[model samples]
Target: MTTQLITPTQSAYAYPLLIKHLLNTPLIYSPDQEIVYRDCFRYDYKTLGKRIKQLASMLKAQGVKPGDTIAVMDWDSHRYLECFFAVPMMGAVLHTVNIRLTSEQLIYTINHAEDDIILVNEEFLPLLESVKDRFETVKKVIVLSDKGAIPASSIEFSGEYEALVSDAVPEYTFPDFDENTMATTFYTTGTTGLPKGVFFSHRQIVLHTYGVMAGLTAYKSQANISSADVYMPMTPMFHVHAWGMPYLMTLLGAKQVYPGRYEPETLLKLIVGEQVTYSHCVPTIMNMLITSPSIKDVDLKGWKVIIGGSALSKGLCKEALGHGINLFTGYGMSETCPILTLSNLKPHMLEWGEDEQVEIRCKTGLPIPEVQLEVVDVEGNPVAHDGQTPGEVVTRTPWLTQGYVKSGEQSEELWKDGWLHTGDIGVIDQEGYLRITDRLKDVIKTGGEWISSLELEDIISQHEAVNEVAVVGITDEKWGERPMAMVVLKEEFQGKISEKDIQEFCMTFVEKGQIPKYGVPGKIVLDAVIPKTSVGKISKKDIRGTYGENLN
Candidate 1:
């Protein structure tokens, strides 16, 4: 027998309740404790909160009414953190623009979201200047710059963010808002077409924060987090709101660090000097960090890291373990509040030996308590949890975006029957662990059978000479669509490894049918590094654009 619990609507829904833990908590515990800013500046929670409030007031004074969109263009910084709180708490929508996108795409997103204001970093001013005339809806430009000189430009209502916030009162009262009211709008990096928008409501974001903080999730204990744990998220703020780490850190009261423009050396220095305990980024960033010469002397033992944005390869996981880094994998997308599952060890795995447990922790873990995940076939039938059958991963959660902002293509299908359809193909074990096999679009079909490109890429990346690898399906007359491999070799091994040697290596693991008859790459184009999205995933779109015509 079960009892009915009281509903949230039965009680008064309050805005401050979302951040009640932070606002009501003691601000004096670490007055002098520092929140490092890109290894350049630092501030305590007291000072940080003051700036947040002042920024809130400044937004209010500038007529940034509730529900208005205020976009931010910057790497992770204290000012960006302030906007994280100020905009949402003030009942406005915070739009994070992906600076890595082409300038035209950036303008398209700004116009699509109807962003009324943009809080930009000094380093990104030139990009904004290039596209300012195209932003029809943007009314104001607040520059978050260290430079004192303000350039005289055609763009109106431009001023330094520091100057504007310094003059405003640091005590703006947050208004009451419906939990369902939209709080954030983060645009997706359109691999195929125009970028689509995913807007999250206040209630969704607040609940996501709690879900992440829950015992079963990645962040189990708040006490483990303090002002001392330095953070360097390789995940860009523009991508799924940096996997919601900015908000989680503020609630945990941890000192946050951001790598401005993501230099591996700069990140290594910050991590070693600041003693960064926790971080989240894609496997690409991890590859760069571990390979960087600057990190050779740094002590990474006991450092907690959550890898996402793409599948974490076993080879990369082993490299991290060798350095004594506590690394785990997470999986999510721009549409699902960015964190649907984490590879944290479950109760059953706790009894296993450390080595066995580490292996389990490397696969994408179970869903967060509130998240309901399933792997379904083309007919929408649930796949078996035997860990062999693969299906499209779908989910229903409180924090998922309602729908794409304007796209009418299968909006119903995306949230059909109340479950958000994630195009990832994956399998779940009896222990409730999820292991993503391949993206639906990236799966190679040979002789009417599916091959996991992700799995192939993982195997290829293990080659000592290979720095990066991307596998895509090319049109084939006999096999429907055959697998094609594009590789970027390490600097030292460049021009040394032949295509025949790589093909021979792949033949060891996969059967002839499982592997395409086409043994080698149709074409090999060498690059210094793989092109990546802002979130740091290998951009297959770029790869296809460069090689699609040749394949045809």
Candidate 2:
């Protein structure tokens, strides 16, 4: 029999799940590991820890206090990583401002967050100054520059980032507080009216870090990351903490390289120079890199990449595989603290042929531990996991965002029925792999049947002359909605391929029973490039607004 044991007095060392604790594991094991910043500078993990303290000291010297919010705008760099920890650890909220947003939307989010301090990159000085007069709560602006020069700007300079931190002490006592304290905030990039603010607490972030680490290390595949691997993020740091990889990697004591800008040449060079082994990006960014003239000579054989933000098409996967890139799909959204599933194969399935594995790799993938994922009907009933039946995907996980910042109505809709509604339609197979069919709002309906726009696009992507394609439901007086194709042909086949060619090619899939006959598009509009969202997702919402008539 076991009994409770307690000291007569407090233990004096009770631990709170603070963000600073994440640095403990790395500080102990790999204090000397390197974190590179492009090709510009490099520092050891020991220095990184010291810099984090310096950053906190600097913030505190600037009067940043508990419950205040601080905003940052910069490319993916070591400085952002420091703020990810320093601001939150000090009890101030870190608002990762999405610099890619429209100027008006950016202003709205800034006001909505009520940030007291803004740590902005030199490049965004003009952008920040343009709306500085309209900000209601901004108290100071700290400018960051890689070359150590603060540019002249209209926004009164509070100080330069490097200069202020240089004079601050390298030590500060981070106080203890409730684990549920708000740690960070960022806005979702939906094409809806305004960006909705989502916030996470210290406890939630710590648990999420553990969950992501478990998902990556527990899997036995090419994407199974370890401390030995060099990490780089192709996604923007302002976007969900670059899909939360920076924290996950640093905790594992992995070497990280931060590319200042996303120019294809720079990325390819850093990949080769730093010997980066693991990376994640949206399909559009990967597409841009793969098609770049510079990537042809690099050795991508052991490069493990997780493609997210949108569905990965057959054409893109084939190209990546041809270059020996270990490519697969991952699924998550801003509301989920970014990662929910990764497409890693089962142990027994490892021997399967490459083509067979690629099929599974391209699916939406299986959920990580602590993520209870379910596909459900409109009434909230669970759907069968029979692979053919489609339903909306919902999930329950501890790390998920509690709700939108202060919008009770939207927050209620987000947590309806005690499950986080993902608004994504998916199908789960017998082996427990989930494949997203389409967004609930993007599915096409015609002739009394539902057709998956993703399925049609994937099929069309395999066509010889196709480069990219988007399928949408266009208005039809008789059918209610009809599938229309916005096709982007390969450069070699620009005008050589016609609308009939695409429609006819789609029917071949129908003849093979791969897709329904009605799934074929009625009209195909050739385009040079398909419009995309800021995160590289197909701009279906914007496309519908422009081309879709009464196609509700």
Candidate 3:
């Protein structure tokens, strides 16, 4: 059979899948819905639409043009949400700058991105001032402030965010362009070298919004979100478009509460005050919320959170469940538009109890709509779906970035053999659920046996005394490499729990045949806290650097 492509008539409108079109439904159906930014501001979707245009108008008046890179440095806020739409809708690339990056990394990303303008928050002005001198391409700065008064800064400001937006016309003609035009760019928080840039097109972002939306709401699951659900983002807006939820939520016109800075108390208050039903975050933020004193007063019932950026440990899952929180694991990286799979329960499995559900939710999960995934062996052959044999995960999806921006060598390596190679090792069950074992680089090879660092962390985290834990491989004289456990005890157990206590806890799982005896670390170091990546995943790279040596 021959493939036939149809051409549209001259009078027919060839609608491009642009970000501006996402506002269509919301503008008509949900114009009255509210969008809140901390305690300082609140506006309906009607105002949101106007403000989006106003922002675009302001940017244009300041010499911003199509294809220019506009970087934003701010906490998750309504202003950031406005930029998410207006900048890209205007045909300029939106660079969601990672505010948590180191000074050098920050400079590298801004300069490497060749950002033409920066919309920086009042709080980040000093940081921006320190690095602005080194920026090679930035031509202007616009300051964002909650108080509506721009803070005093050393750098020259084009204008204050609110004042400029208020002054600009509320209507601007956003030109139609090719759907494949670049819409967004961001740097991954890599541990080894400088941060690498990943970019996406308008088509990819729009399709990802649809794909993730269908996967989350089309099924019967505890983690499902809907138009009625109140939305908030615990994840930083700078990171993979906040896992692209802000776009999805805006399209649904869900009432969104933006917690400007993620203070534990403030986040808890917003949840209680605004009744935020759907949110997403890393496990570290989950732990922070569960341990917060304010959490005791907040009713988390009906609240749904998607845990990403790291493995969702069983301990964290159970803890969240105990607090009446519906939490599930989501899998993806910075390069895959940050959403590949969701651990939403299958309708039949919805009848299962909390314990059974936790197991499924902790898995990397079934691939989302349109996401093609496989666990492949070293030679790139698909591995058995027995849930025991592990292999590197590879995937193809409409939303996956074509390549890392400007890094052709790494881009070629990432898309080797036509499938984007995810460096994490994972396993698939007979039912098609993927369970990530560990990063390929983090797997501990000791005495000719491979051990999963993630498995060890999951086991150790189950201990009652363990507040947070990370497992990394330490170099050994005889074994070549061995697992080393780093633990932080609960506040009350700080003095009572010893390093030996954690080893014995792992032994319990060892005896149960859940893990091999060799998996138990010989060296267990109790500490006050474990270091984390900018995105809040356990920084095994940093941990290995500090304690990877064989002291004995």
- By TM-score, who's the top model here? 3
Cα lDDT tens digits for candidate 2, 329-360: 99999999988998888888789987888789
Evaluation by TM-score, superior candidate among 1 and 3: 3
Give the runs in model 2 whose Cα sits over 4 Å from its true position. Answer: 1-9, 550-552
As a whole number from 0 to 100, the lDDT of residue 203 in candidate 3 is 97
Report the Cα lDDT for residue 130, model 2: 80
Q: What is the TM-score of each candidate against the true structure?
A: 0.91, 0.97, 0.98
> lDDT (CA) for every model shown?
0.77, 0.89, 0.92
Q: How accurate locally is residue 284 in candidate 2, as Cα lDDT from 0 to 100?
A: 85
Q: What's the distance in Å from true for residue 238, model 3? A: 0.2
Looking at model 2, residue 106 earns an lDDT score of 88
Per-residue lDDT over 231-343 for candidate 3, one digit per residue giving the tens place of the 0 to 100 score: 99999999999999999999998999999999999999999899999999999999999988888888999999999999999988999999999999999999999899999
- Among the numbered candidates, top lDDT falls to 3
Deviation of model 3 at 205, angstroms: 0.2
Better of 1 and 2 by lDDT: 2
Q: What number of clashing residue pairs does each candidate have, in the order they appear?
A: 1, 0, 0
